[model samples]
Target: MPHVQPAAPAPAPPVAAVVVLAAGQGTRMRSSRPKVLHALGGRSMLGHVLAAAAPLGAGATVVVVGSGRDQVEQHLAQIAPTAVPVLQEEQLGSGHAAAVALAAVPDIEGAVLIVNGDSPLLTTRTLDALVAAHDAAGSVFTVLTAEVDDPTGLGRIVRDERGAPQAIIEERDATAEQRAIREVNAGVYVAAAGTLRRVLAGLATDNAQGEQYLTDALAPLVAAGAPTAAVVAEDPDDVLGCNDRRELAARRRTLNDRVLDELMRSGVTVVDPATTWVDVTVSVGPDAVLRPGTQLEGVTSIGAAAEVGPDTTLVDTEVGEGASVVRSHCLGAVIGPESTVGPFSYLRPGTRLAGDAKVGAFVEAKNVEVGEGSKVPHLSYVGDATIGRGANIGAATVFVNYDGVTKHRTTIGDHVRVGSDTMLVAPVTVGDGAYTAAGSVITSDVPPGAMAVARAPQRNVAGWVRRRRSGTPAAEAAAAAESRTAAPREDRSEPSRADSDS
Candidate 1:
């Protein structure tokens, strides 16, 4: 038997610098905000692009900014601190933007990956493949291309008879034959740093748009006999760009579907993918269920066997194992194991629930800590309060933590029972095993094992309704009831004697 030698491992992709073009005015979007600042799946488009490029371990990353420079630059600092932002004073074109980005990293050599910041759906896998293809072919210039059914408004890839990419012709400059081409330039490229610098320097504005076209550099590079190629993307949607609100919505839907699909494949159950939206930054553990209308955003994480949804939005919140949150809005909150929240609960920042705790329907809690086995059940507002273990806060309860000036704290000890319609005024405490009577407004602290009832004694004003409310339905009913009570009973002795005579 012939010994089969294993194929030599493919050469490692070269370490390349990344240049992100974000200088477009995007007037078609009809918004004051910059195009790349628009969000998809809870992240700005520029943030998504940067995240995709981060896995490449690029030697340097440069972002070209034009309109809305301040906002874009500020956003860059937050999302990608190490990335350098260079200003493009004018909105010349993509070619001009690329040139400005390259100028920022003058010493960068080897391969450089140039991408559009508006393509949020572009993934790391596709980018890695593009780099590998460029490295394998040893091309000085490689353009990422995609085949689409409609090539309208997109630059067409002009390939020679040998099926090699000769040039990329923009829609305005292309001829009839070129316009018919379905293979379109995806606005992504991998080029040798030296070649890019040379081509961009000599870019011309003779075309229809009268702007320095990046696509024009391709023909010259091919003419100069520099090895150039085109790598077709496996998924065309990976190269889709958002130009208007409709396109942005479409891209968001596609990206959200992809995120949910990955979750379902990894043992997370998505009850309705069409209505459930999960951010790229969110994490859901195995066996967790996400029901319809769930929006998990901004670093939210759900633990194993947790159930979320049926109209829930959690942002920057954490849910522990076996917890359930339904029809609630929670932000920057923490729910411990086996706890439950919702059906109209609003948990604000600094809220924490311990094991077996419950914040039931119509309960709003903020800056409050509910201990293990404690519950703030329906129609309650608990803020700046600490509840001990096994405490039950009854319906219509309010921890009046705010005075006319400053906010104060309310403390409830273990096994305490707060009755319905109770208002425990701030700066008060209910000790262990203490109870507050219904309809009480507790203003002072209650000792251990004691009951606090602070309400006026009951007193009746008889027949006041009939005197004060004459001619009303209630007054008339009161008068009728009094007449019946005052009426005398009839005797039956005479009636028995008359019946015997008859």
Candidate 2:
């Protein structure tokens, strides 16, 4: 016993690598864009697929793109920089695409998980469960499958007498009996690293479509004495793949419903979940209320106790606690606690409002930092500006920040009053306690506690109104000259009492 040493626990297996096939031309989509680039729920289909794969922490994740590689790669740089991209120059087949992806990671020792980039609804839990089942069965190859009522476009799963998956047959290639099979291959699989590379290398393009089929690999893997199995997904809809615009729209609805459900369950009050759309990347804290027709997209976050929209859209915005955003469109802005924005307003990128700020109807603010207790009341454009605390921006006030040559900034200090219809020309400042007169065009700065009026002085013409009303200026002047001449020659007489009364 002393001489026999205990064997160390087997070292944990390496994380699986992922290969996503995204090179299909998607002619049925009837658009110039790549199929995987089509958006659903404010994100492209590839984005959603990558999001699902992110939790796996795969050793390597490869995306195989063809038709629009440049656009896809550009997006990937921002969304999934860690994942590698490989190009499949021709529209061959899924088998060829996988081969291309596998060539990039030739030395991966662990399993390879192959997934379709168009299947955005796949959950990480299902993927994890599939991997667990594969490991538990000790199979060299495992196919993810689902039992759908109508397996029309999907490849049907062929099973042996023991209900073991033997192969997958496409609808076009399936016989009548195979067509009756209810279990369909979901186009997702996990294969031992070496087995996949070897099988894909030997795959032939002898099918009716004259293209290599990834499903063809299953038959060989099964016949070679290698263990093979299939995992049936609990929900068939989870494996839905988009090919055209109709499918894309259906998928978008499904994703939106799922997002809304999750948000509602997390202590957020959704007044109308049917009309509300929250993207997968957005977060709303507890006690927040999302009213009808509200759309939160692109990594937006709403703090606790916030009220958003009867109809509003917020993109990549940060909303603080207890804020009310109603019928507004805000992008890349930060709204502070207890702030109220819009019956109608547009808050552009770099706009930040401190607590107790109000941006009223028809107000547009861009690249401005508004201090606490400041209000851009209504019908105003406050751009490239900084507004200090307790400042009031009157109706129709505009910060004329951009000249023909360049853009400039306007500063409004604490307790400043910007009168209605005022234009603060840029590179101008209204100091603390300063007042700008109504309808003023302020080109220069106003010092502290000063009033600035930029308008023409008033002028009066004594008889101008009567002369215009008479419409005979020359005749009236002649009559006055005659009366003056007669008055010097003889006594001027007053009108008789009867004529005056008449």
Candidate 3:
């Protein structure tokens, strides 16, 4: 008997290769795009499956791509970051797909783990366990199977008296006795080198469907007295393959729910799971709270103790610890610790907020940075600019960072105070501790500690309102009234919803 070590702290040994059976016309999907190429959240369908197959630390990863071979190859190359693709030209059964995949995986001294690309929920941990279980038992071939409470449309596991070894009988080919069995083949397998190699070679297209049944190969392995056992996965749903839109939707929801659940489990608080959809790679630090209607996607990461959502959408954004991003749409941005963003703000790509920054309601920031303790609190567009620490930007402030042709930068130094409705034209600088008065359109730079006020002389129109009310000429009233209302309009409150019914 082989020597057995006490509970090992390390993970399982590496496998020979992972054979991904992805090739299928996927007729039920009914799309010009391959079913495997369909987008789930921000990633393609193949991406989810490839992610599952990765981290197994297998020697090689062979993907069987038939219908969308070229596209699959290209997508795998792009998104997988790493992982090799193999071609499966013909539309054949699972057995045939495995045969082609084996050709791609060179010299297999260890075990070959077969996984269906549609089974995206199967994690790398499961694959590792399946391989470990196979090798530990000294089985010639081992398949990842699951017991279904209601085993309809699934293959039944037929075991001997000792429940030691078994063969799988697909629902289509099984007899009445086999149909009553509860254990089903879950379409994931870990097979030994010599046994799997011979089985693939001997696979005949002698089934009722005129296709080589991979399940039938199990019978030959059993006949040869090579130990064959079913390593059942804890959850049967993980092995579910998507054939139609309904199945695909269910799978996508399941994966998303799992991602959300993991976040909650890791000390993050999610108010609602049904409406909140987060992508697979997203991370939420401990004590982070995501309220309802939050759709966080891409590689978004929310830091510790952060509060987000209640109708917020973020993509590819990194929010630092103690940050609060609420009711906003932020993308490709980074918010530092203790920053607060939006009741209705839009932080677009290249936006960065240093610690303790406040980007308040109705603000739009792009390619901009609000330094630590800086505040761009209301009704502002700060784009292509860098506002330094402890700066105060008053309401309706605008960084005129773009000309008609090229975009420019506006640099505001520390302790600067930009007054309401101030427009700082770019390639300009507001020096340290400078104060720009309200209503200034500053085209030139302001020196340190200086008070810059740029405006035309205020003309007194004392009788302006009297002229407008007491039947003055329409033209003059229009001009005078406009000037009178300008200041009030600049301080306008939030507009009421036009289509809102009382």
Candidate 4:
């Protein structure tokens, strides 16, 4: 008979469900806001936790909510619409929370993964490994463990003589020897749904906290002769949880550093990672450069070869290929290819700049569309305006768009030149190839190729300054100029014909 190899065992079925416990009041955080709702890297802590688990392809996800239920549920709806939120109603222990979550998905079987909602640093990779280890060992329950420098307030993992996890002892109930253990339970677990359901029903509230502890389940399962295991995470930080503001800030820095490191590895240039922040939701194409003091947030994207910052913030904005934005604040805006914005500029919502357009130093634009090659350069406030291709809006130009009652629009046609110090009153149009004279306040439309000069003609009032202010420096200067003008001049002109003949 030909040699036959046994077929490889089939891969384990996908996780039946993922239960996230978020019922803590987080009194130590000292904020009315729910601790899980506190944000880092532009996403709520719950959001990050959910996001990390989303790739697991779990059949269903349930978040157990209690304090600030309304806000947490509302945010959950926004971030994970498909995930169900089950109210814990009471400040029970982790064991009860898991039971409530499981009840919400009664039909689920196979493995259930339980995670803490405040552990935003948890990675999908660690979860995957834990599940895989459980399936391979055929264990009825598995706990994720970590070896930290200080296991201060955490539950210690107690192992048998054979180096297999025998039970988990909470710090408050552990003896002095157990308290010295550095290997701590991370509070993340994978368990057979049926076994977990049975074990949770028998949990007792006889511990120091008088709450049903999830760690208690390990003992009964072990005693019942059911296989149990533990998986140590590769990076202990992956299981870190946030309880206070100081820890939250530390995690924020760690998460930001991770993001920047990934970006750099993927061909993005971060000149100063310490001063640069990018939300996980933001995308940057390869070769894009983010300089110091740059913050890209809220679904913002930067295209290839784009340069941003040296003190710039962009939110919900799109910066196109080869564009440059420096020292500006932009929100809900679009910067087209090869365009330039700032040194100091504010681009508000609905602002769009076409290719090669320029919004220079100290300029503020809102709800404006700048056409290709157009320039609104330096000291301008332009709002509700449409600037045509190749047009030039001179320095100190103001588009008077709001009249204290209603906003209005101003349109400038192709190649139009708006002079310095011009005020374009809204609801007006400048025709193609037109020019507005310097210092003009244009209220009416101008014909094509015509110059609209709205200012009054120059008028001289002789000796007015001297008469108006007789003793001031200006009056003295004016009197001196008047005397010089009034004094007779030596004859610099050629003599007349009669005088030459004489």
Q: Tell me each candidate's TM-score.
A: 0.93, 0.88, 0.86, 0.93
Tens digit of per-residue lDDT, candidate 3, span 1-502: 9998898676544677878787887899998777788777667766766677677677787888888778888888888745667676666688888888787665766778888777767776777677778878988788888878889998889888988656787788789999998888888888876678789889888777778767778888788887887788877777877888998799889888888878888898999999998987788899999999999989999999999989999999999999999999999999999999999999999999999999999999999988999999999999999999999999999999879999999999999999999999998999999999999999999999999999889999866556666665765767776788875544336555653543
After the best TM-score superposition of candidate 1, give how far the Cα of residue 154 lies from its true spot, in angstroms: 0.8
Q: By the lDDT metric, which is better: model 1 or model 2?
A: 1
Residue pair clashes in candidate 2: none
Q: Residue 460 in candidate 4 has what lDDT?
A: 96
Off by over 4 Å in 2: 1-14, 459-502
lDDT values, one for every candidate: 0.93, 0.91, 0.85, 0.94
For all the candidates, what are their Cα RMSDs to the real structure? 5.5, 6.6, 9.4, 5.2
lDDT-wise, the better of 2 and 4 is 4
Candidate 2: minimum summed lDDT over ten consecutive residues — where? 462-471
Alpha-carbon error at 112 in model 2, in Å? 0.4
What order do candidates take by lDDT, descending?
4, 1, 2, 3
Candidate closest to the true structure, highest lDDT: 4
CA displacement after TM-score superposition, residue 467 of candidate 4 (Å):
2.6
